[model samples]
Target: MDYSLLSQAPLFKGLTADNIVTILSTVPHRVKKFQSGSMISQSGEPVNSLIVVISGVVKGEMVDYTGRVIKIEDIPAPGALAAAFMFGDRNRFPVNVIAVSDGELLLIEKPDFLKLLMRNDIILVNFMDMISNRSQFLSEKIKFLNFKTIKGKLAHYILQKAGKDKLSLKLDKTQNDLADFFGVARPSVARALREMEEEGYIEAKGKYIKLIDKKGLADLTIE
Candidate 1:
């Protein structure tokens, strides 16, 4: 087996494949495979193990009161799922993690993971740092959720990414995926783009977005 998969997980970072093999010989872990569209982990489920993806992509999502499925984020292989949830008082996952494609996951029990951390000061410190970073990321996600309009969200996102000046759209998301990300309907996103163009706020051709009026976009973000 290519124990190198261990290197991909944040918890097992810096450990060589041989070292990972040695560690795994004593640690309790099991690998599970998921088909595309399968729910890897459910929201409100009793959290126990730390899930590390060895291959493929998974999306963390949740439904709001209005039955809108908001995608929290996407996790590609070699990423740990919900690493921040392992220690907190309310440790349950806030979102459902569903596989976007065929994937393999390594499940390590909390106690076993904790045991590994106990013997390694580096691992413990790295774990804490990971959680701290996750907290900051969640805070940003909350801020993103606060945008009142699709245009406001799009303006905020474009400005935040490529800056508040003239630039091409630097999006890593498809139109449908971007719509899901904004927690809005696809037509709404399309309408917002059309409205922006008609209002002379932006000049967009395909994926390219030239900020015609940066100040106007900024004002819309706040309004």
Candidate 2:
């Protein structure tokens, strides 16, 4: 196993490679390999272990009643899988995790994870920080979901990225990424951007955007 990769994981952020090896020497854990497109975990399944991606990309997705698949987020190497759900009474995966590429995972069973956490203060602090950050992310996601149109979602996203003073900024995510995040088709996002530019609401040249009508964008965000 690559102790360096394990040390880079968010759960072990502050620990060194030597530290990880020393610690894991006392903990029972295993490294598992997965193929691309394989299911890592399904929604509603118990999160009985602390699983961290060691070497690949994975995506979290959900299928609604209409059978439309919505991508939640992508987790690459060193990212923990369902870290927040591990200890809760209703500990279950909120979305199905599917491997985007062949990868390796480090699995530490729940009880063993608890033991590991208890043995290291840095690891415990990292775990708590991860959970708190995830809560804020989910809150923002819910707010975006409340938007009724793709244009509205795009407007809100721009406003949030630009902040209170900035009027020009570059989009951090690509059109395809934005589509997955908005739970809409990629062309829908591209069309919305084109329409917004055509309507004089913004000036877009590739990823760079200059807000032309800030108030108009804000109005779109209003319920």
TM per model? 0.70, 0.82
Give the Cα error of residue 145 in candidate 1, in Å: 2.0
Each prediction's Cα RMSD?
4.3, 3.0
Clashing pairs in 2: none
Per-residue alpha-carbon lDDT of candidate 1 for residues 193-223, written as tens digits (9 for 90 to 100): 8899999988878777888888898898988
The best candidate by lDDT is 2
**Candidate 2: global Cα-lDDT?**
0.92
Model 2 reaches what TM-score against the true structure?
Answer: 0.82
Taken over the whole model, the C-alpha lDDT of each candidate is 0.83, 0.92
Regions of candidate 2 where Cα sits further than 4 Å from its true position:
32-43, 55-76, 95-104
Q: Which candidate gets the maximum TM-score versus the true structure?
A: 2
How many Å off is the CA of 50 in candidate 1? 2.4
Assess the local accuracy of residue 189 in candidate 1 as a C-alpha lDDT between 0 and 100: 85
